[model samples]
Target: MGRIVGIDLGTSTSEIACIVDGTPKLLPNSQGKLVTPSVVHIGEDGGVLVGEAAAEYLFTRPDCTFMEVKRLTGGGEVLKAHGKEYRPEEIQALLLGYLVRCAEESLKEKIERAVITVPAYFTDLQRRATAKAGELAGLAVERILNEPTAAALDYGLANLKECKNVLVYDLGGGTLDVTVLELFEGVIDVKASCGNNHLGGKDFDEIIMGRLAEPSDSADPSADERALMRLKKAAEDCKIALSTREEYQVSLPFLLTGAEGKPLSVEKTVRREDFEDWVAEKVNSTREPMMSALADAALTPGDLQVVLLVGGSTRIPCVKKLVEETLGTVPRSLVDPDLTVARGAAIQAGLIEGSINNEDLVLTDVCPYTLGTAPLQHGIFGRRVFFDPIIPRNTTIPAEKSKIYHPAVDYQTEVTIDVYQGESSDPANNERLGELNLSGIPPAKVGKESVEVSFSYDMNGILQVKASVLSTGRQVSAEISTTGIKAKAPLDLSRWEEAEGARKFRPLIRKAEKLMAAGGDPGGDVELLVRRVKEALLLKNTKEAGDLRDQLLGMLEALEQLLQLQDDRTLGIDRP
Candidate 1:
């Protein structure tokens, strides 16, 4: 019954907005700025500080300040500052609560719910962590909207009747996302999205830090943590200046102490040309996501009517130029890049709250990752495992897909369907979301026992998997969720790099993929060994991993021999 605004909970900055008089407007903070920094601090007295006040402690009290909390959203890392431990979600809550207070003061209404925006490529865990942060702030989260999708909403609201395909290129403070969307006849459908969370303005800041450090002979200015934080601040300022001017001079008084024991004042005059050169690689990296999005949308540069730019990082001149060169089209800035997501979120909140006309505002999104289950089968060596994709990446959200698999062994009475999300053909290379185990299956022949696994991915990115035995009608289900609303503790990834072996075993994987691509296989007995090795690695069994590795390698050599034989046969040449 109260006001529900939209919140763009970003990595480097955060903002809130609401629809007033059928127009979405941003709510400014106490500092009179529409955008608020996402930085958090723990005061000496253990008081929680946020936004501008928190930024004041960045250099002097680097130990008490926390930046880039967004990167820890779904992970299990705690910030120990000022003799206090704070979870990433807790720090975010402080910032969100500040925004809520700002909104309530500006609107003179008690805000209860909000629609928050995150990166399109965020996992279900990450999305839920955002909602948990909102809950910690005492606000009911209306929904978790993707950042690019939110930006598209802001773009679509203006051109409701236009039939055009638009690409959303969002390069923000802490992440970069490219989304392809088509708007026609009051509908906005997201075709594809790709991004890297570790890439953005923050990385550019680091490059600036390195550039500024090149001249320092007194000491490695970045050697001390405090000095590094100070340099980081300087880097940010230098970056903002280079965006508009050909050159900018930065002088930090007493940045470090020289070998002579006197204070070292660092000064550097950076040319925009040089700045762009350092950042050119970072900017170029975004090109991959743009192409990936284009391919996923099944469109070309000529197919797009407009290229929309969103987020503060998009303001950089180099970023703009790179996008134009790659997309072969200039960016269309109908909305402010920095404020677009929050404004779009406000529009979403308004639509949900019935404060604006939204009957024509139909928006459809997609699952950013492939969803499937691990099923076992018989192979030449032994039992083989495969990761069959059920709901593929970029498939429309609020979508459900199912695939049927039969038991591998005769007289099997129980079955387990381990769910995973990724693009890898090998299930072992994917992320395990959850699993469903069903019992009481009718004892039958290997091919006769049938089981169906269904994956339902909603717009919020949560996945619900249901499994059933066809013969006995036995069923089981599980939903992968976080400490959603009531905001409890979170879950930890079993072993983050257990799949590091996947990278080391790339050659073998490629060989298997090539063999499968050739069609009509089964000449080699390697699938079973590969499956065993993957299972062992996934279980973090080092001994088993080593043993399986040996087995897989030997079999791989045989498979390579078999491949050579196939090549000889295809050429109609007699073997030596």
Candidate 2:
């Protein structure tokens, strides 16, 4: 049988692994290293380079190198490198092909099928994009496993006899994912997963570079592509150094030219304390995801037996402190965080290939996003269509959920089903997955004729939707496409007007009202902002939503403080 290798296709770095001699091991790349830099370079000499060679190419051919292509996966974003344009997934395919070649050379055998890991929060578009990249690279993608889930699988397998609630904190180069998993007997069930794909160690590197680079409205011609690339490399090196050292010296000689046309230089010695202070806000951004995961699982930090740290970013001393403070425990650092995902992928590959006989290692995943359809709702502003989630986020995979939707008009014999993925009360506010058309339904009065729509999300992340007429047993079904393009636009639901505000944020508004009822004085300002933010999000005004969210968050913080003080007074205890 052909090998079903496990691949950790990452934004900043990638690794391939396979089970050998009853154990999972990372395969060394052509550079004889386990961690391959996810960098590709189209050479000036009409050649191609990947990994270490490609990463370093930035020093001389900055415009020719492509790094972090994983960020653009399924985003419909485009890139240009070395005067040649490429889709994000195409770049990924090139890198995957390189890794496959390395694996083939190491094993002295062909590898066809493989399991690839992605962020759990990856949308249908992103998930399918990763799988398609694998196919473009000439490998049959066996499974698309979540990165945190893969790591948990590896950890769970190692401690098979023990039961634990393990929280997986994965902060890699370009994203942050926090997942809570229940490991019982031999079954591993993911309770919850949440993350921000735009945040990670790369942000820290950019922060450091910003400190060294001069800010100006005009271009610093002296700091050309090469110079900027040099600064980036230097920032990354210093970041790694500060992980173990108290301080690191950064020096860039002949880095650029000043406006005066003189050769400029950059030299700075950054202290570990200073870096930690500057990056504190970025560190704090990760807390929401952790809290969200715990909330989804109905768990507290105290409920977690141990926190498992994964990804290279966790090596930062300050990051560890943040996790310990938030989770109320010293996180387990024994596992090789950077390689865990790939190694676990190898373990999964083994299972798929029948190379491993551990049938007790039962695994279950959940739909990372809400599955819903647009439905009519009566509101204060009259009738409007809102997002109606049939299956909410965090629901276990291989699970089924159904909801009855009724016709909006009398004697309506035709209906169009628009499926979306998100947890928004407003339909247009979420990602539209696909749409379906059903006809020949028995006509009746408004809200009288109905159909039961069921969403069955399997472990593979594919969604099977079945619509059955209540008057008749007539049924129609459609599957969410892995390519994500199956969802056609101009959904024919445009006539469904939206009031927008006071929809999704209704819960927050009520919570604020409760606090006020309990003697917390948020005033009308908090309520006003909530209403405004909802309108902003509905209007697709993200800038306004962002500003309002900050204001709302601050008001909530103050209200919480008031509640805390009230509790303290009630207990006759001093405020600490």
**Candidate 1 residue pairs in backbone clash:** none
**RMSD of model 2 against the true structure:** 19.1
lDDT of each: 0.82, 0.82
How would you encode candidate 1's per-residue C-alpha lDDT over 517-574 as one tens digit per residue?
Answer: 7652463234444544554565466677677667767766776787788889999988
How much does each candidate deviate from the true structure in C-alpha RMSD?
14.8, 19.1
How good is model 2 by TM-score?
0.80
> Model 2 — which ten-residue stretch has the worst lDDT?
487-496
TM-score for candidate 1: 0.79
Candidate 2, residues 341-387: lDDT per residue as tens digits? 99889988988887776686878888878889998777799998888
Candidate 2 off by > 4 Å: 44-46, 217-223, 411-414, 437-444, 466-477, 481-576
Candidate 2, backbone clash total: 2
